[model samples]
Target chain A: MNSTSAPEPAQPTERIPAAERREQILAAASRVFGERGYSGATTDQVARVAGISQPYVVRMFGTKENLFLEVLARALDRLVTSFRQIIQEPREAGPAATELLASRLGAAYVDLIEDRGILLSLMQAFISGHNPVIGAKARAGFLEIYRMLRDEAGFPPDTIREFLADGMLFNTLLAIRLPDIFHEDPAAAELMRCTFRGKLDVVLDATAAESTDADAAPAPPAAGHVDAAKDDK
Target chain B: MNSTSAPEPAQPTERIPAAERREQILAAASRVFGERGYSGATTDQVARVAGISQPYVVRMFGTKENLFLEVLARALDRLVTSFRQIIQEPREAGPAATELLASRLGAAYVDLIEDRGILLSLMQAFISGHNPVIGAKARAGFLEIYRMLRDEAGFPPDTIREFLADGMLFNTLLAIRLPDIFHEDPAAAELMRCTFRGKLDVVLDATAAESTDADAAPAPPAAGHVDAAKDDK
Candidate 1:
């Protein structure tokens, strides 16, 4: 059989630099930690998802706590960046700045949740507020976003608070996968219709599409293939 | 030593029936599980807080999972019950029914969080939605409240959704203890002022009073003083 068959080609091992690998690991950790929460998740699981060794994951971040902090920080950073981008965009002088800002930021938030991990992970961080370190960071991170909207985005305090209130409610909706329950549960369907103002289908479609993409992606091989070889044995 | 004090009077242990004991345990568990997520809390802590034995705590609820389910159920029940009470109260016939209802319901929620456990526990439960059992209960429990507002209370779907949105944001504020940060963080103070609309002082006072009440309560001795005696040893 070996003699008759053509030799198998060697698989290419893409060499990712340290900075890129760090980003990859943080992204994977966000998803894992978001799903399992801080205490429930482990570095090993993050490593597996990131296709990196457990030791390497720890070495890169120092500890699971540090990794979670980094993930949370990145999530907050992304949120601020999104809001800033929206504020920077040119608009027709129609709606009041506050109203336009609210709508634009609300849509931005809806877009952000398409990633699933980012919003959920930030929520998990907030729920873990009993931990003094995490609690402080969560409070600071939350205020940072609020301050950005108030000062940078030029939204009034009331508008900022209202926007955040709606965002938080949307977080709960996504956390419980309310969109999935909509069709089967009439109240849920009605609530979503009212909450999104007839945009329920759009959000549902976007979420579904993202989930499909996640499912379709093959597991990336380990950086060195060391663990991959061990698994085969 | 006891005999020296004029034959110390007999310390009578008030016999609590199973039903009362169950309620006591649920209340304590709500506080514990609210402070510590599901995975972080233990039956022993609940038992200690309830002045019951660990075995009794487990026996009463059958399992930790069942205890959590009951706690969640009670939280939802309390919310619905509060809203119902508000709806039944005679109105002044001045403000629109929708505005009156919203204000009443909002005040009820603020009062509920005075316990600091009920609202936070419900939020923690919602965040634990990745677990199948919890996810189902959280979804159903949330929908139960929404349906009550819609079918029973006769609020429009839009009003219901908007009410829930504000509620979810309040949950986040309480979860992160924004009231505690209000004085130290100008942004938090502004956010609370805007969100509460000049009612920040009222909430802060209420929250402070509740914390003082919690602090003044005597620690409950475990049943038969088993664990209490062990700690003494």
Candidate 2:
């Protein structure tokens, strides 16, 4: 047992503030829902991943749909923050900078895959357009990012559109689990090699760790928040 | 009542060949599965859409996954045929021809949406990369298309990549039902206007007809094949 200290289960948040605990649950839910998909994932699975009781997950998010909505929102928030960081950074002036920024922006997006659920969860949200609530949020968020790339980032219209296009294809690759099939299929391997480039190892490692994680039992609820980022490695 | 057929209940396809009937069911299943993701679709629903009985659907496809696989294959085949048709057309030997050809290729891909399920079904299949068989098919088919654009269509590497990127984003916009919320959300409306350009009306009308189709009862099993393209209008 990894439990070093056992607090009474009733007051699980005695030390952590409500806001901080919410973040912890969201981080865990992101990975769970992103990996399993919204329909296939359950609140119980989210609780297990978050190292909290099922009732706690239900109490915090109210419903599975609500939990997913929050997770989706967080993923978008992270994306905006990532792009903002890149845009705010100082860079040289010229066509080269614009070109560099586009690739850098793309690399930043691909890097989000290391966070695992952030990009995958967004893909899940993107395709869930039939759902009234999720679909609206996905559209607004997607376009907001588009606007940021165009307006704030000063990317030309065609360049920014291509950037977004690349991002969309990247998401499709992940959704199809291209990394998993790459070794066996050369076509997938070539596509992965081209699309992922240097990040292929990181992508492969993240997904590989997940399959290994599939066998492990849920950590005890008192085990504390599992850092999805580090654990995924 | 739209039904004019007076066939015996047990002999719905008495006049139609089994092979022809298979195509009818696959066509219907493409729409049903494309509109509703694979897990959400049922054999009975597909049968009703195909204007055939449930037993016939089950007999032909054996299972819903099998039915979906056939639909997915048909979608890919259609994609290849459309692209090949574009690629084979006569063109001047110059950069302008390549430029014109790329747009022609994209327009052809977009026109596949007029078939409704063909494009949406491909979208469904693209994201279904989690399934073993479907994922394999999706990757192979997607890459095959990629190679076609690059090799046969004679697009430069970067250009072809963007073409695919645009196509993927196009699929995302459709999957999220961006056309539905274009009127209410300015972000959505703007994005739809830009991404769809001239085809905005076609995209909107297709989704609108789908929502309306949602309310209508399934066609009678003996009423012969329902041309989904015609009904969506």
Candidate 3:
């Protein structure tokens, strides 16, 4: 019901004006869903919050779920922006990177949680079934982020296939979306941060010390098989 | 409606058989919910998966939500058990502890994800509103675990009040429960483990080095203020 009055001018303005309208709609959806939850929220509420009519909202996005998925995508893009900002600022690699990344990721996650917890909750609620639309969109965003980090970590795309980025993505999402779970004991957060730093260091070090000749013949499929098998349930 | 069954004698077993019963119920609930989304699942279905009668399941737990909460508690407890087993072993404090803890936590988290994804989804669904009974139970269980770890970490009973535990719990839960986000990216899991390990080492070292002098001062009012802030949204 929000399509007819969409603020799109079909022409460019000084601000690429469509961007501002999209942001307004996304923010409204995030706030509404975060507060009222996904199933409990309505497109009318989101439209009202966006200062746009319901038909405009429909024009911008077909449905409430669709709007929610778009917002989640934007949130991830924001994280990528933050990560890039951190890396390009000429920070040292060791403890500095660890601490900065922790705090940055923590803040980003907290903000995302407060803004879009309900949408995340909805995604979690329906992630398992065979519904590919929402899952694929979110997964594709995650893979895009991981792909950027692939060269940073020095792993081939084929080998990265055996990994599970979903676990980490969920961890960050849950940390923000479920503050009660994270805020229960302060030590838990500290412990988790330390754990993440240590493991990240291992990956970075392994990548830095990689041997070009190690891939000469395939290095025995059994080695990769055992590694993958152990990782498998 | 389910309480219509006759109440049995409250005879206690050698070690608290009710605990065992709770575990069995949780195990069944885990598999059932993991396979089918919560909305698609029923108490009878859980009972069948658990190999008990539906009435017995209802008599023991008031509702599906209650059963799912129990499963979450069990899952957290399982992770804690592994952590304690490794941490308390007579090993020196250093990188090895960090590595062992990270790898073990990662493995346990992966297992939980594979085994109990559905229960986590259900718990998350009721996290926001209309499920205080379940929320309270889950929060209390989480707080209990957090408090236990805080005491061991040398933080006075009420001194350390960061929801770090809650964040860790939620993050780890998401890590496993939302495999679509983590399954494809192994480095994500590795980075999380390393990060947590690195930060946890700082905490453990501080606790180990804290002398009677540090503990002598009755925690400052600032500490309380900090706790309040920490607990605030």
lDDT of each: 0.77, 0.76, 0.47
lDDT (Cα, tens digit) per residue for candidate 1, span A12-40: 33568999989988988888778767886
Q: What is the TM-score of each candidate against the true structure?
A: 0.82, 0.80, 0.48
lDDT of 2 at B160: 66
Residue B52, model 2: lDDT of 65
Q: In model 1 chain B, which range of ten residues has the least summed lDDT?
A: B1-10
Instruction: Sort every candidate by TM-score, greatest first.
Output: 1, 2, 3
Query: How far is B52's C-alpha from truth in model 1 (Å)?
Result: 4.5
Q: What is the C-alpha lDDT profile of model 1 across B1-233, one tens digit per residue?
A: 11122211243335788898888889988987877777767777676566555677899999998999898888888988898999888876654977887888898888786665798889988887677798899999899889888887788877887788888888888777777777899989888887776456677886655431222223344446545555453
Interface RMSD, all candidates in order, equals 1.3, 2.0, 8.4
- Is 2 or 3 the stronger prediction by TM-score? 2
TM-score leader: 1
Q: Pick the candidate with the highest DockQ.
A: 1
Candidate numbers, best lDDT first, in rank order: 1, 2, 3
Tens digit per residue, CA lDDT, model 2, A116-221: 6898889878887776777778877888897897789987666766677788888888877777777787756766777777888888887776641321455444
> Which residue runs of candidate 2 sit more than 4 Å off their true CA positions?
A1-24, A51-56, A212-216, A219-233, B1-21, B51-56, B154-156, B212-216, B220-233
* lDDT string, candidate 3, A1-233, tens digits: 43334343333222337777888778767655544444445677676565555677777887766887776666666667765665455555674554454455444433433343333543442342223465555555645555654554333443233232323333422323323333555644444344344343332233234222211221221223544556433
